[model samples]
Target chain A: MMTLKKIAVPVAALILFGLFWEFLVWVNGWPNYKMASPSDLWPAFWKFRWLFLDYGWDTLWRTVAGLLIAVVVGVLLGMVMGFSRTMRDALYPLLVGFNAIPKATVVPIIALMFVGQHDMNTILIAFLISFFPIAVSVSIGLSTLEPEYRDILAALGASKLTIFWKIALPKTLPEFFGALKVAVTLAFIGTNLMEIVEPHGRGLGHLFDSGKISADYPLMFAVLIALAVMGILLYYIVVALEHVFAGWAERTPQ
Target chain B: MTDLIDIKGVRHAYKTASGPLPVLDGLDVAVPEGGFAAVVGPSGCGKSTLTRLIAGLMMPDAGEVLLQGKPVTGPRATVGMAFQNPVLLEWRTILQNVMLPLEIVPTKMSKAQQEERARSLLALVGLEGFEDKRPSELSGGMRQRASLCRAIVHKPEVLILDEPFGALDAFTREDLWQTMHRVKAEEPFTGVLITHDLRESIFLADQVVVLSGRPARTQYVMDIPGKGPRDLEELYTPEAAERLNILRQQIRIAQGRAAA
Candidate 1:
């Protein structure tokens, strides 16, 4: 009952939003080619369901593969950078400098290098854009042990390896989860944005580009709907992982 | 009695914008083996610094701290210490926290034996059922007890407690005095406590060492004559009350000298 009431307000608001959207389309008096109502987008979803599924699978697998690469490289590099002063000073500024460059601009260079393999282009773009956040989060997690806890462990003669396993690694889980929340969404955004760069590609971004040229507004709306659903699904997965690893953390606020 | 832990003419300071802010000025302390010594001083009197200094957590700039007749150049791997805060890691369960030292420092005991020791230590502290509980689930006093258990589980040569009960309420603080005594009795380790409470010093230790103000020295050391079970009623008795008053007066005199 509590859960139902909790969702009731947002559900009602969505219904009103759908009504308002249909009313606006009706008042515009434009044909379905120019404008789409909620009802029109609904059937269009069923009509292009296969196109949506296939393209979505392609984009998702690329994004996830890229995200996996980012996690591996990011965490390893972050740990090394955190442990050594020389490595941190050498790599941190370069990383920040690289992160500063708009990843979308890197797409054309990556696209040229890959030359017609948009799948590779999409994955590279996603990995390049999303990797830095995970790196920064992991480094911060490694750095921020409470002095007393460190001292207590030190007094017990804990070596760096022990400290990493007992203290640094557990503290990093929350930050890794937090960064994953941002990086995963940005991975999808990166793939789609890069996909639009090479519109001859086969992802949702290319489909949207084609729909725009053909003036099929409902089809574009259908792509937007799929993107929204996919983003929520990805975000919830990270949130679930956060709960699994850092569940003891929910009670305390720091 | 042989001195097991020694701080010899220790001179240390922290650097600041103005200049060097001196803490310990030719300060000295010695604790015999299997003895409990409680240190009492004013706020900011370098009491905590003295604890760290003896524990080898921090080095003295111009002097040396020796444990077991050898200079302590780094954290004494076998030294067990606890602060006012439990300082228990949030990520680890109470059992894991207690077992931490065994994992870090090489132990002769098997895994099962080490775990058995941790469980028994928790039970000794009245936290038997809470071995699996996270530090956050326990109350402040319970957490401190768990921290105490963690400190002694490894059975170190020395136990340095810096205001271990300072944060607790009066009732809880009194309760833990008994708990502290009971634990120390069960496992005899050289104990050094840095605290602001004279009564706690008298109640918990065989000898109470008082410190002067900043850039502190050992101003006075008084032996509290008692054995076996300690009772709250004893603290209010004329002799114990008078001893506490003398210690309080000694601290005021030390502070006065520091002010001068």
Candidate 2:
């Protein structure tokens, strides 16, 4: 009953929001080209569902590829930073500085370099944008390799690599997964940014650009709805993976 | 009996930003093979440091820490240690945690053989059904029990315990004192326990060594009256009470909390 009430409030709020948007457009005497109402947007969504799926699939795969590369690179760099103080001092500031730069500005430069291959630019830019959080989290996790646990391993005569494999990696899993959830969202942001920079890279961003140029307001709102749902779907996939990999965490009493 | 663990004229100190903070100065400790010895001292007197030195986790500044008459330059695989906290890997099952040391130090024993030993050790500690449970699932007492099992599963020549029950409630701590005694009795490893509780030390240790304040040096050593077949009830006897009082007084003086 409580959970149902929780669901009911959100659904009711959504309905009120849709009605409010409809009323605002009506009050302004906005034309169809300027604004899309709930009624018009619903039917338009059904009509362009296939197109949304095609472009959504493209965006999703590019995000996944970018995130995959980010995981590999970020984890390697994070390990180097975590273990070696000298290397961390050398590389950490550079990573933070690189991460600080505007990814949007970088995307155009990448698009220029790749030219017609905007898809590669999209993935590369997405990877660049999403790399830092995972690397930083992994380094933090490795560094926090509990002193007590390390001492126990040391007392047992476990070598450095053995200690890492036995204690550090397993200890860092929750942090790794936590970083993944954040990285996935950042990856989606980068994908959308790149697609907007070069609409030739097929995705919801391209559809959004086409909607604007043609002034197909209903189609534009529909694409926006599709992008939101796709983001939600991908985020929940990472959440489910977290459950699979770190289920013991859920069962932890404290 | 030969000394399984021996520290002669050992001096250890840590460097702080302020200056050098001395902890142990010309300290000596020895435990005979298969004997359980407890080192009791004022808090912050570096009792844990003593355990670390014996385990070869740290190099002593000026003297030799020997296990079976060889200098301990680094952590030797034959030294097993269990700290106050259980420190079991949360990701591993109790059985797997017990079997962890075998993975670190290569053993000729087959996986199946080591596994059987792990299971048996868990069973010995009354954790048979809990073999598959993660450390977080168990109570604090149970986790510490598992930690003890893990330390002994590899059958180290010397087992170093740093206040294994210091965090437990009085009742649980007492319960585990029996458990500790039982484990030591059964396994017969040369044992060194670092604890604050004098009763606990007297109840479990064959000889209780008391140390003085900072830059700790042995002030006194009480041979708890027993060779074998000791009981907890014996702790309350007049002779034991006098000994316990002496031990407490010595530690009190060591901590500068009371007159000698």
Candidate 3:
């Protein structure tokens, strides 16, 4: 299919870039400890595949759990804010102030709060990163109903609850998916950052930290590759969902 | 035979930055049961405001709008409306969009009955095969047609259209006019249309009420002279052209007054 061709271009380009990178290292006679070649990383990955998989699964579960909770809470808050001007006025400033704080700075505090539970710390980090986009996107989506559509519903004698279910929820779906895509990537990054700072969690970040401590450049490179693969996979999962919900929307005049 | 709608000395104004600017000034009109009427005027003449009032979407400051012998209070399900934009829910398929009113009505109809009614309406609009297609997949004219189907699917006693075909191309507009005429002929609901197109008013409406500019009031009420089943060819007649020219002049005068 044409879509496959489009995807193939970027994938082929990435493979070529990896080959070019390996060629550059080889030609320059760079030390393996300084910059590991793709060939070196591949052997290292094979040796540590099971260990990498366990870490990846742990981080993945934490991110997924955190993202789900954020979506549920964020959507409810957003709906309340969107439908009630009083609620928005009361809470929006507080939310903005909270969002303004540097999320990275909270990792240490979160770790301290959670103490020994690595899963709890990771979840907190992911939630902090993912919540903002979902809330903001849902609020915007709820507010962006066409005036005529609103008027039509109002004129039809639709109750507030009916309007929310039939109009608001359906209209907000595409936007929610868009926000979800961003949140998923952020969730991954947030979980990884939490791992990096703590260095005790079972995650790619812990793997990378161990590699650095042992001067294992090839292992670190392999972990970075795995992280890239995971990010792409998670992002595509959101994309697939967007396609399901919004496939009807894309046929409009662009 | 009581009037289906009575707009009695309705006055409305908006609080603008400048001051309270009046829009509708003691306007009054009566529409008989099952009558097809059109309100035509220049852009600022508040024709849309009148439709909104009749549909009970807004209240007049100084007067009352009566629907079926009751004073219009708020939006009522008995009144169906369509706008220039199709305003179809992008997420719903054509059948689902048509079935929307059924869902919101609070009267529990069996799902089978709703689907049957939706299909009947879609068939009426010549969209039987397009029941599963999304609004985004339809053409502008097709979408408007679907909107028309949606508006009437619930079988409301009154239907209000605000420039329903204004966004379509000339050929498509003419085609839809015929479609509308046929639908109106088949189902005898009290239909009120607000439009700037003079020919459209004459071709479709039983009575065309022309309005003066803002603070708008009814300037002229002309009876469109046509018997059973008119077509696009009627638009080419001298009578149609004369009516159109008269409307154009009245709109110009109204525009001049608004400017002054």
Candidate 4:
């Protein structure tokens, strides 16, 4: 019953939002080219459903693959930076400089360097954009760990590796999940940026670009709705994982 | 019995931007095997630094700390510690927290045996049913109990408690003191308790070592004169009162508020 209410509330709000958008468009008497109503989206989706599915799958896979690579590389780098003060000092400025560069600007450069390899460029951009949050969150989580916890393990003659496995990793899970949630959204933005910038005739971003070129505004809106739904789906997946792994961190009603 | 923990002429200072700030100055303390010594002083008297030195978590600059006659050059598995914060891992259940040291220290017990040991200690501390509960679910006093179990679960030769009960309410603190006695009866390790509570020092330790003000050194030692089970009522008795009085005066002297 509780779970049902939890799912039902946001879903009802979404329906209300759709109705509001439809009402605004109708009141203004805007042409579909100016602003597509919710009513126009269904037909556009039905007409191009197969293509949307194919393109959506391509985009989804790229985001997922990039995020997976980010998790592996980000965690290792974060651990190194978190464990050693010298390494953190050395790497932090570089990481901040890289992250500060707008990922949108990097897409053209990536296109220039790896010309015509659209999928890899999208994946690379996604990985680069997403990994920074994960690394920063993990390092902050590790460095701020309570000293007494380390003292307890150290007094036991536990090795640094053992302390990481037994304490640091579990302690950092909540923060890591927070970063993963942020990284997932960033990953999607990265993937879409590459597809829109290069327009290699693949992924949902490419489909959206095609819609814009043909003046199919409703189709473009439908593709956008598709992207939002995908982002929401991945976000919930991460939330579910957080519940499974770091549920203790969040206080539940007794 | 020989001393299980020995600190002789230990001096340490923390180097700051201004200069070297001394903490422990030529401190000396010892606790015989299975003995409990409570050290009390003014707040910043380096009592905690002494605990760390005894646990081998840090080294003193000028003197040596020994455990079982061996110089403590680095951290050793034979020393266990509990702090005022009761810093139990939130990710672990009460039972897993107790079993942490065993996982780190070299041990011959199989997994089942380790679980059994932790379960027994939890029961001893009146936390039997709370074995599977996460650290956050328990109250502060209960979490401190779990922390105590974790410290001694490895059966270390020395247990250094740096004000483990300092944060608890009076009732809870007294209850835990009783629990401490019960645990010591069964587990039997040398203990150094650094606390400000005079009654707690009297109730828990065989000897109370008083350190002088900052740049603390051992200035006085008072041995409680009985060797059997003690009642909390004894704390109000004339004999215990005299001991408490002497210790209070010693603390005053240590703080530079009274004549020596």
Candidate 5:
């Protein structure tokens, strides 16, 4: 029953939000081209559902591929920074400066370099934009390890590698998952930015651009709704993974 | 019985931005095989530094630490330690935490044997049904019990308790003291307990060592009468009261409040 309430509440809120948007459009007498109401979206959505799926899958796979690469590289770099004071001091400022650049601006430059390579550009952008948060979180997790825990293991004649695997890795899982959640959203943004900037006729961004050119506002709104649904779905997947790997960290006694 | 742990004229200091801050000077401690010694001193007088030296986590600048007639050059697998915080890994259940040292210490026991040993230790400490519970699920006393189980699960030659019950309530601390006796009887290891509680020292240890103020040295040693599964009731006797009074007086002198 409690689980049902948790699922039902957000879904009911979504329905209410759709109704409010529909009411506002109807009350203002907005044309379908000016703004697509909930009524206008369903037929258009039904008409192009298959296309939406294809393009959405394209975008989703690119984001996922980039995120996988980011996880590997980010974790390695984070471990390095976490363990070595000299490397941390050397790399920290460069990472901050790189993260500060507008990824949107970088997307165009990436497009210029990898002309017509839509998938590669999208994946690279997603990777570049998303890895920073994961790396930073992982480094922070490793560096803040409690001294007492280290001493406990060290007293047992445990080597540094043993301590890393036995203590540091498990201790850092919660933070890793936290950064992954944020990175998932950022990966989507990076992929979408590249798709829209290049308009390679392959992903949801291309479909949305096609809708704009034909003045089909309903189709555009359908694409926006699809993206939102996809984002929410992906975020929940990360949340589920977090529960599996770090469930012990989440428990609170009654 | 020979001394299992010996620290001879050990001295150490920490290098700070200002200069070298001396913590221990001419410090000496010893614990015979299967004997427990409790070290009590004023805070910041290097009681902990002395534990680290014996455990080989750090080397003393000027003196030697020996275990079983061998000088400790680095951490050996035979010294087990518990701190005030318990320090059980949050991700591991009580059983897994107890079995951690077994995983790292190169034990000949098979996996099943290890689990059995850990289970028996947990049962000895009154945590039989709590094997699968996480550290946070247990109360402070229960968690400390689990920590003790973890510390001695591998049957180390020496066990160090660095104020393991300092954060516990008075009743829980007393309960844990009894538990300590129970654990020591079942799994005999030369033990060193660092605590500030006078009653705790007298109740749990065969001998209590007191240290003076900073740049600390051994100030006094008092041997408690009668050991082997001590009852808490023994703490109320007139002899117990005299021991407590002498310890309090020694502590006062250690704190520089009373002249020796």
Candidate 6:
């Protein structure tokens, strides 16, 4: 299990980075308000573990709900666009225009429109951020199938629905999971950003903002570490699912 | 003999930027029921295009393709096809891939019956043990065999193959040729194969039709005479060699025309 080949340098570099952070805190005699050492942040995390967990759970649920909606809607629309050239030509420009809009800039406006409801604002933000990649990736993946496959399906006298279900869906699974991986990370980011602008009753983004205002550097560092862990956990969930469904995507052609 | 599939003075051309570039120039061919026919020509000679026409994937600009005395307006399940590349659905198991046509076609059989038919077809193609394996998990030759199973699962009146074994290694290709011969002998469906391999055409086809290059035309059609379905031993025979030489000469002429 210990594959040491080529990983030593990166591991060493990470260790060096930890030492540099510790060295910077010690040498500069930085005020606790400005920077928290590992010792301070560790204890702060333990003290507020339950509060952090509640906020993390709220944020996590909002992200997942919004992402699920986005994925369902995006993939359906993308399939329509992929199957019909006229629809693609008609809708793709609008999609491109929408994607170009700064989603974060509109977060406050969306919060106002939704009447400052925490769940609604967070969902809208996540939905906006997560939908584009799924749509684009699904369309591209569906359209890029080999021509010979199309000919085979046609020769079989396969109905349009049969072709879509049997060929297009399975062929697009790897790309769909790939796009989901990207979309999930974006969903997390969008949720947190929304919480910052429109602070919910309880959430990690609200916690981070509060730490900033109160000069709670140790608490802030703990929240930052928690955010990193959350992102990794979410990403790995999608990665694991990808492995289960489209494991052949990873195999190099022999 | 009545033709199961007929191509009558089929003139096909594509509208290019320069103008209409002709592919098939007034080509006429016919496959009687239970006939094994091969179309052999040089590469780029539109042999595959002719197969496409017969399969109803594309329509000729002039004339018509008839299946069972009916003009082919679009694809029909009664006509099955295989390509050089075994275009199996990567996600489905071999059994599921073979079951595809049954699911698509409007059939009276129950799901269990459909599945049984698919299994039998797979077994017929010498893929008895590969029912659960995905197309990606199978070897190239194995995938082609699965493709054959899928093609014939619906029990089509005519099976069209466009160099289905061209991508395999030599050993695998030869082995598949025998497998194909055995399958044909057992089922007795009309087969139309488009291949560049002269020996493959002679070994598998009851009659081989040689095409002229580019704007392809049926230049020659030779009957393959033997007592039964051809085997590898037939390739070494003087009769097979004479037929192969004649086909080779036709291909050389086709290539010369294409170059010109």
> Could you tell me the lDDT of residue A215 within candidate 4?
91
What docking grade applies to model 4? high
lDDT of 1 by residue, B166-232 (tens): 8999999999998887887788889899888888999989989888888888888898877655888
Q: How far is A237's C-alpha from truth in model 2 (Å)?
A: 1.8
Model 2 alpha-carbon drift over 4 Å, by segment: A1-35, A42-50, A252-254, B257-260
Candidate 6: which stretches are off by over 4 Å? A1-30, A46-50, A89-102, A112-115, A199-202, A247-254, B106-117, B257-260
User: Which regions in candidate 4 have their CA more than 4 angstroms from the true location?
Assistant: none
- Give the C-alpha miss distance for residue B109 in model 6, angstroms: 5.0
Error of 4 at B123 (Å): 1.4
Write down the lDDT of every candidate, Cα atoms only: 0.86, 0.86, 0.85, 0.92, 0.91, 0.85
Among all candidates shown, the one with the greatest DockQ? 4
Query: DockQ, in order, for the candidates?
Result: 0.71, 0.75, 0.71, 0.88, 0.87, 0.63
Fnat of candidates, each listed? 0.81, 0.83, 0.83, 0.98, 0.93, 0.74
lDDT (10s digit) by residue, model 3, range B1-260:
77998888889998899999899997878788878889887787788888788877788889888888899888888878899999999888899998888776655568998899888777776787999998878899999999998888788888999999999999999888888877777666888998878888888888888777789987778887664568788889888888888777777777765321
Clash pairs, candidate 5, are none
lDDT of 2 by residue, B1-260 (tens): 55878889889889999998999997888888878889999889999899888887889889888888889988878978898888998778988889988988768999999999999888888888999998888999999999999888888998889998999999998888877767766788888999989899888888999999999998888887666646778878998889888998898899888666
Question: In model 1, what is the error at residue B96, expressed in angstroms?
Answer: 2.4
- The alpha-carbon deviation from the true structure for residue B132 of candidate 1, after best TM-score superposition, in angstroms, is 2.4
> Residues A137-160, candidate 2, lDDT per residue (tens digit)?
889899877677898788877888
lDDT per residue (tens digit) for residues A69-166 in model 4: 99988998898898889999999999999999999999899989999998899999999999999999999999999889899999888888888888
Per-residue lDDT of A206-234 in model 5, one digit per residue for the tens?
88888888889999999888888999989
Off by over 4 Å in 5: none
Query: Chain B, model 1, TM-score against the native?
Result: 0.95
